[model samples]
Target chain A: MNKLDNQVIIDRLQAVLGDKVHVLGEPHGLLAIQTESAYILELLAFVKNDELLRLNYLTDITAVHYPLQEKQYAVVYHLHNLFQNIRVRVKVFIGGEQPTIPSATSVWQGANWMERETYDFFGIHFEGHPDLRRILNMDDLDVFPMRKEYPLEDPNRIDKKDFYFGR
Target chain B: MSNRITKITPNNPVFYDNDPQDELITLNLGPTHPATHGVFQNVLQIDGERIVSGVSTIGYIHRAFEKIAEHRPFYQITPLTDRLNYCSSPINNMGWHMTVEKLLDIEIPKRVQYMRVIVMELARIADHIICNGILGVDTGAFSGFLYVMQEREFIYEIFEEICGARLTTNIGRIGGFERDFNAIAFDKIREFLKRYPPVLSEFEELFVRNRIFIERTSGVAAVTPEQALDYSWSGPILRATGVDYDVRVTAPYCSYEEFEFDVPVGTNGDVYDRFMVRNEEMRQSMRIIQQALEKIEKEPKGVFHADVPEFYLPPKEQVYNNMEALIYHFKIVMGEWETPKSEVYHAVEGANGELGFYLIHDGGRTPYRLHFRRPSFINYQMFAPMSRGMLISDAIINMSSLNVIAGELDA
Candidate 1:
């Protein structure tokens, strides 16, 4: 199978989404594009089902937290074209207050757990997910631990304090 | 026959309607079950001996490695990588190092790359040995598991000779290995190469044609190619469904493209197919290791690590004797170094699947945000759906075939 060119994929995405697509250029040779949170589901479906750029594989779904940015959370989607042996990353930025985006489960069934994991860590709500819940954290935990605002270590723990170590 | 009538109170309701369709028993399969092999919980709704549906709950051992990575420097993260997939620590270590190298745009030496290939391939063989042997144990062939497990011990001895640790070996550094492989390590690897093949073949013969093993694994929890792709499956499980996507072949990190080996693929994504794929993959890993050994011998000595003074640690003797070496060592250890403000995603063909590191840096001592694309976490997503309507025994075999390590899954 002939490998699909990255430029071709970017062109196809731009043609479909128009100004809504912001091409972030290829990082480490992966075509990365950022779009609004609202267009995530539609853009993903178009990319997966497109005739020329058939990114049929959903490699991963994860989120990054940027506390200082305007849209503080970025939901990162990695899609792989198995036939072409190429991968592209898609990012959808959402506000920190109510980070909600349409779920990719409609397009790919594998997104169910990944979305739950994203929600579990970064508190990004997937609008149409069937069973969105805490995946890798305690059920009663209220804090999104992956957020930049949260301290990496527990502040209440006195075991590792400098005074205890005689510093 | 005389009829015996038992009286029941209204509250007791002894003679309630017992419809098979309505009576589904919920069984908690783990969080501490022997068959789980790790700390995983699957609440299975069973009808008779078959599972009707399953709800999986991971994170029993979640260490929050991503959050922790934000606080640790690039080199300190190697030890943490050791815990992700303890079965294949060298691969995780190499993957993390390669990600950092990608961010720094540092070119590694050819000898360093070949050494990494050798270590990563050995780790892959160790990982597959555990998976296939455990599958035998899951299917009631205990003797084959024991036989293969002994071979795994020899591999561990080689690891011990290399890094002084058996399981969680923090073996290599960011640029390259901390030191060169000694003669003892190479000898042990050679010994492993000479002894393991016949044992692996014997292990395969025990289960390949066994009627009971075939009945238990063949066509059980079979997934279509579309389903496998949709679930983001990678590694042997993904290849079992006839998808020819391998990170090593596609991306070719650590000089894997130079090695000649075939990606073992299977048509049916069933337990049997997964078993066959992993079994064949072990042989392929051995083939890679043999080629790597021959190549490593041809390379010059004492070129284990790259010449990155800022990142790579100096030798202890140099640190003690030289002032500049001492300062550099202190700076690197104290996390007082600068990094480029960039983001890169690097993946390696991990034992379980595509273990990727998506690192975002802001020129800080630590990463701004780091994400581990754990393949076990992604591949294990299909477990609940695949378990639906399968026999309880078959679900156990299916779980073994998935090879979901709790450390990697919960990380």
Candidate 2:
């Protein structure tokens, strides 16, 4: 799009989202929208498949963990509107206690696996997922390996003598 | 839940008393599959040749890179990004350094920009060649694989001349390249430019007209442009679906705007289209390399780094001569460099697709969070849908055409 057209879209989005729309860094055409999980599904529905927004593509779904932040986890979705030729980032801040957000599978068919990956990595469940099982990790593995609080395997966790002598 | 799962599997009963119950056949398609570039396994539940359901089993090669970054300095992580997508390591190397430079808000010199472009484009070509070549081999045309490897070896030879290592080319330092291309390397690249077109033509000759290859790939794993974009597929894969969006052109990282090249798009979004798109892309990449070389020639050789001496180690002469430089050198080597307290997502056009590194620095030596946007992992997620109704043989071709390098997939 031309420079003026780009500005108009940005202006409209800014007015719509207000303080929730925090532009990061140099803003090389990435619009990040931070909102609550309650508004996630509605917001996603509005952005995706809408004639104006048309972010019909769900590029990726991942979660970011910030141990020090008050909202401990963030579920990030990268969406691209093929018709509009624009990309937007939808972020939902989830607190530490049983973080969950609505799945975008209804909006974009590709969100199925991306949501599963987010669930696998950060333990943030999609509220209405079809089959929310742990992917990319073994079934019995308890902890979310990508979580900030998940303790890394200690180099000394395996004891050779204990294995051989049956200690 | 167990009953629901059981119901999902088919079952039939008539007058027959002892008929076998239909069940999901679980097959692990390798942490070590020939088609999978590295150690990556996908647990697939199959009904006959069709995949009923599939889940990716990653972390076969998790080296704890983020944790390792916490202990090491910013510069040390360059080598690690190299390992993430070994085929296109320089792009990662340059991308990480650019992120650090952005965090520091430093301006790189014009010549350094040219050098970065050269190295990054070379890596992109190498990655595409292997990816497209392997796609051919997986489809039973082995000649393309050989031709592409020979060319990749030539690319590696140039890389070796520039840096010590070929694949894990830790060639560039923070802000710019580790060293300028020596005369020998320059000559070798020029020779490659001359020799590469014929090799590409020969490789194309083997598969472009072959009826078997065409029949196998032309319509298999067909994804709509909307579907591809929604799934976040980029680079050759995205372009193959007719969307001409390229990170290099749209985002213009590492001075990509200055280079004159075309983003080739395909009409049909299928395995054949993806293959054709990548093939044409390699030619574009060569054009980029040639342009970079011309720019490098016109520009005078000087410092290939930002003036940030603290993050970048001091010159060896200064380290040997001055106490301050010696102390700084030790600190840099020991990874005692202080990182800025900021979050930066630096992305570049990797061979497969958009390779992004989301880094959160805590104003310490270590990063608070490190996430790699692995294109292969995201790209592989589309496999089950793409392979569901296709034959097992076509599924193999689709997997190869997707070019999901397991190193990047599992990491």
- Among all candidates shown, the one with the greatest lDDT: 1
- Could you give candidate 1's per-residue lDDT for residues A1-167 as a string of tens digits? 44579988877888878988888888778889899987888888998998899988888899998888898888999888877678899998889577899999999998998899999999999999999999999999999999988998778998998998889
lDDT of 1 by residue, B209-321 (tens): 99999999999888898889878889999899998889999888988999999999999899999999999998998899899989987888789888999889999999999
* Strongest candidate by TM-score: 1
- Screening candidate 1 with a backbone cut-off below 3 angstroms (N, C-alpha, C), the clashing residue pairs are none
State in Å the error of residue B80, model 2: 1.8
Candidate 2: which stretches are off by over 4 Å?
A1-11, A14-31, A50-59, A79-89, A153-167, B1-28, B35-37, B42-56, B334-339
lDDT for A117 in candidate 2 is 71
Clashes of each: 0, 4
User: What are the per-model DockQ values?
Assistant: 0.79, 0.32
Output the lDDT of residue B199, model 2.
90
For candidate 2 chain A, which ten residues in a row score worst on lDDT? A20-29
Docking class of 2: acceptable
Query: Model 2 residue B15 lDDT?
Result: 29
Q: For model 1, state the Cα shift of residue A145 in Å.
A: 0.7
Per-residue lDDT tens digits for candidate 2, residues B1-411, read 233233343453232344355876888888787766677677887887877767666667766665566556677788888888888888888888887787777799888998888888788889889888888888888877887798889889989998878999888887676677788888998899899999999999998999998998998888888788767787788898899878888777788889999999988889999999988988998899899988877877765777777777777899999998998889888767666676666778888888877776778776767777788878877887676766767877888888877677766
